[model samples]
Target: GKDKPTYNPKKERGDVVVVLNAAHVHLTHDKWNTKLYRWHTGYPGGLRSRTAREQWEADPTELIRNAVNGMLPKNKSREARLEKLKIFPESEHPFEGFPLVPFLPKPRLLQDRGLGWALPQHLALVRWCPPSLLLTPRGPGLGAAAQGFEPANPERYRFRLRTSPGLQGGAGRPVVGIEDLLTEEERRALAAAGQQGV
Candidate 1:
């Protein structure tokens, strides 16, 4: 009697990857004609070669398998890891009985051109702190207020700063007139210190 292999989730290190529509894989430029797959047939002058286009036409799954095999590390565990990969030329697959989770990429952040407030030369620093500690003080500001400081105002004080370019076109140079964390008294003191070259 042949023994059926049982799956143990705790023992497995990687997930079973199933790729469909292997035939429709796009090859950039002239790779379809230029790329060649060579193999030996274990006989005298048994070396054989096939173009990528010919290989895809004969067995599309093999094309994908070769690509994935090349990408994998050249180690002893490579064969075992490759066994988990299942490729289908078409959308049809036998793994419908098992749960399949589709892969989704994470959303990209908005670039400087996409954001109206963001500039090409300026670096934007956006920080979101708890409202209780800085904005709405039930008793007193435990952190900032305790140090004799508070945000200028709830509406104006948004923990966002834009840094401009410094001398020699270097980044991280702080620009003035956008201070949101200082009170009127603190601003006056800072202005007096600046005038006195402090």
Candidate 2:
């Protein structure tokens, strides 16, 4: 077994996580009905309570915040770590100026839960290139003829894989529809971007 690492109060534990479309979060089984969120208003007989479903409908972002906060260790640095977690009820966020990477959950996990795929509609517009393709010279190497036809700015080229809303999985597999995969906000975003579905 490896040795236990020492705790460093000054060291940062992880990077900031920005979660979008928090309203679309799904609760397994009957958790939405059974789970309860209780709090007091700091007044006499000011106790208030609501079910997970009620709370989620009232404030979608709060569910994600509570979930993440519950998982963090109860320590002096808990508040600092919690602050790094940013959750948005809708898909729109103000972090466009920053270089952000799309985090895709494992296909198996989604498939197991019959959730299909969840991805931002704008991510399809992001320009990306394989490191090998970027490094390859326009010479008679692998696929040389194709390499010769290079754009002035290779990074400017965008690659998109469009999936039709009506598309279905293989035989006996679950029929994952656009309505199942994308939230209403994301669907609208896709429409604004001129893409049918992703």
Candidate 3:
């Protein structure tokens, strides 16, 4: 599988080997942009960062190797196995006798950034501030409202936190009131907009 931890022992079967392209494997969109590839020199304060976009541009094989390296157990056995692995950028791989079985792509975990839909407050938390900084107002509610960075956009990522009662119109689902959820300033802004809409 592309970018998946795997082992295919050709010696078990009668002299057959599988060679993977290791270059053209597709990474999920945005993963190749935001995901960081890191390394350390084992010295004091030594860390390196490389984006997937950069890796794909420089050497796609390196990206595949790094991804596979992370999956192997960190020990002498792993080192030996890793040394035997051969990755190439071109379409050809150096395995003969056994037919090359195409490595199927692995299903990606959705633990990435867009995983907000799993929770109500998750996506909503992005509206006012990140969860790490969520706090009660310092002085009054107005100060907290002022500190808010961005207006909550329900349309942005299908934000499904608390919203207006009539927000969806006639199914007549229990619509939460602005007074119940919003701060004074936020309620006033929403009210003003509704007036303008009218």
Candidate 4:
């Protein structure tokens, strides 16, 4: 009959130890919520269950330890082997006394910026103006208009609704209808009393 390997805390087993940075470990999908850990006490009706997220939040080190322990052989030395594994929430560890090597994780990029689709390279972001201000006759693009400040491709952000050049009364003046300069009553009286008896 084969005998179970006895666990020895002092004995150095030729096994590889892996220490993962819990913060850097990226879990995929809903595994954090769906994956569960079930354990039973030695007594009857002592079943217990916990989600990976719950286990992690409660004790991050325990989650990794449980996962790794389950994968190893269920031998007497399993507990001894698990003692070698270590998981840390941060990149730093207290094993500086030993010759420790660093593990570099690959950088992951977002597949999309969530803007739906690509915008033209010439596009410029313009600040929004309220519709009330836009409805005014002397709104942004009217006479003597100051172009709004823009970052990156300022020219592309120009407001093309500028008053037509023909609408200008003079070099820098906007055209004003004659009615604008006269009141309705004055205009009517002036028209009726025109020229002393021409």
Q: Tell me the tens digit of each residue's lDDT in model 1 across 1-198.
A: 012265543343577898866765555435666789999999999999998878877887998899899997787767877899999876689999999865422222224555334332211111112322222121223233234334455444432322211212222211122134345554454434333333
Q: What C-alpha lDDT do the candidate models reach, one value each? A: 0.53, 0.53, 0.46, 0.47
For residues 122-190, could you state the per-residue lDDT of candidate 4 as single tens digits?
112212222211111122232222334233444543432232222222242222332343345544443
Give me the runs in candidate 4 sitting further than 4 Å from their true place: 1-12, 15-20, 103-198
lDDT of 2 by residue, 15-114 (tens): 6788877876655435666789999999999999998878987888999899888997788778998888889876689998988765532211111233
lDDT of 3 by residue, 8-111 (tens): 44221122223244454444324555789888988889898887767767776787678778897776555565666677765455565545544322222223
**Lowest lDDT 10-mer window, candidate 2?**
132-141
The TM-score values for the models, in the order shown, are: 0.48, 0.49, 0.40, 0.43
Candidate 1 lDDT: 0.53
On TM-score, the stronger of 1 and 4 is 1
Clashes of 4: 0
Ranking by TM-score: 2, 1, 4, 3
Error of 1 at 68 (Å): 0.8
Ranking by lDDT: 2, 1, 4, 3
CA displacement after TM-score superposition, residue 155 of candidate 3 (Å): 8.5
- Give the clashing residue pairs of candidate 4, or none: none
* Winner on TM-score (2 vs 4): 2
In model 3, the runs with Cα more than 4 Å from the true position are 1-19, 42-45, 96-198
Which RMSD values do the candidates have, in order? 21.6, 16.7, 20.5, 30.4
